[model samples]
Target: MLRVLAVDDEKPLLEELLYLLRSDDRVLSAEGACDATGALRRITRALESGPDGADAIDVVFLDIHMAGLTGLDVARLLAGFAHPPLVVFVTAHEGFAVQAFDLKAVDYVLKPVRPERLAEAVRRASDHLGRSAAQRPPGAAGPPGPPAVPLAGPARHRPAPDTGAAPAAGSAAAAAADRAQDLIAVELGGVTRFVAIADIAYVEAQGDYARLHTDAASHLVRIPLSTLEERWAPRGFVRIHRRHLVALRRIDELRIDAGTTSVRIGAAELQVSRRHARQLRDLLMRQATG
Candidate 1:
């Protein structure tokens, strides 16, 4: 079970986050902090009072746009904590995805949260915690340390590595590549594989996961469509409907039939939601010019 802290300056949003997290079967406790100060204080108190030095917070669902200190600011402070909780930024803005990922956030969820989407974030956080536990040395002296910082910015394409020589750890290029990976990891037949974002024709939401459609196959990943929309929008993926996101480059044709807007990507014809149709067309026009 996971113990979580929900932080947001807005009272209603904080309440919503808490409610949603608490409703999950995986969550043991869900608490809210109206600001960064309160969150830090709670974390300090929890750490100080926990039995045998265990962390009280397993994950933090934070809001990016806050009054006193933004979620990013809070995250930076968490970097200094001895046992920093997994941070999941729940924000309306999509532009912050790069920075959030750079900060090593477990996941970035969009505003007007969906139950399935929120649940997916929780799963990601759980996976993160499990990985952390597996990597930690047995009976370590102090609390588990903060997460490692992720490299900033999109990576430029580089040639494949040679089997004979391995690149040194923390190489600038390697870090950049890690940060800028256009590929998303997906589990296929009990094996992990990387699916290139460019090759993805479209993405469809599937409860707590997403179906990544490519030319030859589709892989179901434990990431929500909203999360992918925020992360990949800057990379030519655009939301065409509530349940679907299409890659601008893979969209071979757009159709408006009987006042209904739709797009074609590799024989898959997906209807664009009324609200997102105009935006999709505008994006298509922009792509046409660029």
Candidate 2:
């Protein structure tokens, strides 16, 4: 069972969310806050009360665009906590999905919210909490204890974020099957769409987030370009441009004109950066021969 704090400025939606959360068997308690400030206050109070006490919060389902402080700002603030509540962004906007994930969100649920989808987010959150508890040092303080006041080391050391790269693979076939591919999640017509790693034709960088483009559509996710480059290198998704990473298998033809080089994928032609052009040609030749 988990204690959840759901925050949203919209009254009816917030009420409905609380109802759905309360209905879940895994939820021990479901509380609500209209905005970031109130939610932070509740969290501060819970932490001050101590983790072994009654007021602890295990997770927070936050909305992105809020008055006063946005959910991103709130999550950033919470990241500094000694034991912060896990965040799950429940909002209508999909643009901020990548940024939310950068903040280490448990899950991103788009609106209009569905019972089943929210349930999935809760399950993920529960699993995260369990893993965290399992990894804690022996006899360390229990979960969800925050300082009511500022700590001496407010900037507590955080562990490293996982590199999206796959492990050493023996063969291409086995590698694809064993790769640690995260099915990029997207919301389409109120339904969640899962984009498989293999289906991606290419990736385009959008600042902090990366966009996954397939034959039919493109989906944005909260992963950096550099991270994807390292992670997908084993899978042959090569960096052609700073803003572009194309699947080597998807390349149709290589073009060079006026000393400029590019690769054609279907009808799209992406320029190959001067530094990477030679590497791309060599890899393509090796792939063709071997």
Candidate 3:
């Protein structure tokens, strides 16, 4: 679990960001500051209390454009600290990405924040924390520290290393979130493999776990079915039934027989619940016509 601070001058955006961060099981706590000054004050308090303290912030989701001191300024000031909270710049503009990286920001997120995008940022932050935690000597002193050096320049685009510290609970849906949002991590036999998101045809819920089905086989992961639904919604995975989530692009045909709704993906036919029938049909129709 990680402690997070979200800074955005817009009240609605700040509230929404806070809600999303707090909703994540990965987060220990989430707080907000409307501007750079307030964010700095809160950060100062947390730092003064010590890094291991209850109020310590592990990551800061900052808006790049602000009235007085911008998020970039804060990041620069943070770099001067012997220990600094990780910075993730949020902006509507793509122009500042280079500058943000130059300031050592771990991730850069664009405006009208998407849940999956923010989730990816959180995963990177978690990996940094995990890797740092693993490197620290046992029972060694002062607060769980930030990365010795932040990921910046082209290095920021590189995938995170396996921290080997019992990783994030997201399955195929979130595994892709670990880095580039293109591949999902799955453990098969005794070895872990990265599965392409484009290869997953559907996901089936099995108790507390989800099984990712591809062309050849299935892989089970510990993450919940609901978690995958939320994160993969943007990727075209939709709830066809309470027990099934199918990829829109993978659907071979939609079938309707005597008021029953079902979909065919390859040779497998899965029933679509009445509640999700309309939405699934709408999405599929759009996928077809658009």
Candidate 4:
């Protein structure tokens, strides 16, 4: 039985979420808020009043954009606390999905929520929370205590080995031979394009679609940034900003202007928000040294 909290500025959306959550047997309890501040207050109160005098919120469904104190800000605040609830962002705007994942959100669901999508998110959140609990250090106190979420170190990009020559007939296939044939197919508009992961220069979030930029051209695909990041982050696609996820190999240079940092890749420049600048700088320095 997961105790969940939902926050959204839209009254109708909040109501709908609450109704859906209440109907789910897996949800032991649920709460709603119309803004980040309200949500924070409710969470604080719940923590203070609980039997153990600490919040037991297992999951949170957060809306990225609100009148004030964006969901990302709320997540940041929660990150400071021990054992923050698993976050599953419910957003109409797609630009912030990458940032949500960068903050280690459990999942991201789009607006005009579909029952199946919400269900899938809940399932994923359950799995994540279970694994997280199992990994907790021995003798650690239960929920609402400050527990650190492990952070992955700086991003590193490495190009795949070239396999131009064909293997001889009837000979054993090389290990590289197996990888050369693997690629993800992306469909955009009415055309399907085969994109070898190595060819992608970057991926940008645009509303409900993602713009996949390669050395040759860019294509718009109907996929969430969170989905793509989960698949590609281990393959060297790094989130440098909220809206931008760049192939570390594609970064041409890093520049600072007016106390803000930016990364240049090919002809386009992407801004790095202050919160992420230090991590990005460390990644860049590591790349230079290596």
Q: CA lDDT, every prediction?
A: 0.77, 0.80, 0.80, 0.74
User: In candidate 4, residue 84 scores what lDDT?
Assistant: 64
Looking at model 2, which ten-residue stretch has the lowest summed lDDT? 148-157
Q: Who wins the TM-score comparison?
A: 2
Error at 27, model 1, angstroms:
0.4
Cα lDDT of model 2 by residue, 1-290, tens digit: 99999999899999999999999999999999987657876888777766656887889999987643468867877877677878999999999999999999999999999999999999999999889889989889855544433211112248758887765656656766544354656676778877877778788999999988888888888899999999888877899899999888777656666778887776677889999988987765444322
Q: Evaluate residue 63 in candidate 4 and report its C-alpha lDDT on the 0 to 100 scale.
A: 92
TM-score of 3: 0.49
Runs in model 1 with CA error above 4 Å? 50-55, 144-290
Residues 39-63 of candidate 3: C-alpha lDDT, one tens digit per residue:
8767876776667877688899999
For candidate 4, write residues 1-290 as lDDT tens digits.
Answer: 78899999899999999888878878888889887656776666554454234456778999987643468867877776655678999999888888999999989999988888888888898888778768978767555543321122223568858888765764446555645555667776778767777778888999888898877888787888878887887777878777888877677656666677787777888888888788776665444323
Give the worst 10-residue stretch by lDDT in candidate 4.
146-155
Task: Assess the local accuracy of residue 151 in candidate 3 as a C-alpha lDDT between 0 and 100.
Answer: 13
Note the residue pairs that clash in candidate 4: 47-55, 82-146, 82-147, 83-147
Residue 216 in model 2: shift from native, Å? 63
- Model 4 earns a TM-score of 0.48
Provide the clash count, candidate 3.
Answer: 0
TM-score of each: 0.48, 0.50, 0.49, 0.48
The CA lDDT at 23 in model 1 is 93
What stretches of model 2 exceed 4 Å from their correct place? 142-290
> After aligning candidate 2 to the native by TM-score, how far in Å is the CA of 223 from where it should be?
54
Q: Which order, best to worst by lDDT?
A: 2, 3, 1, 4
Clashing pairs in 2: 47-146, 98-222, 165-231
Cα displacement (Å) at residue 254, model 4: 33
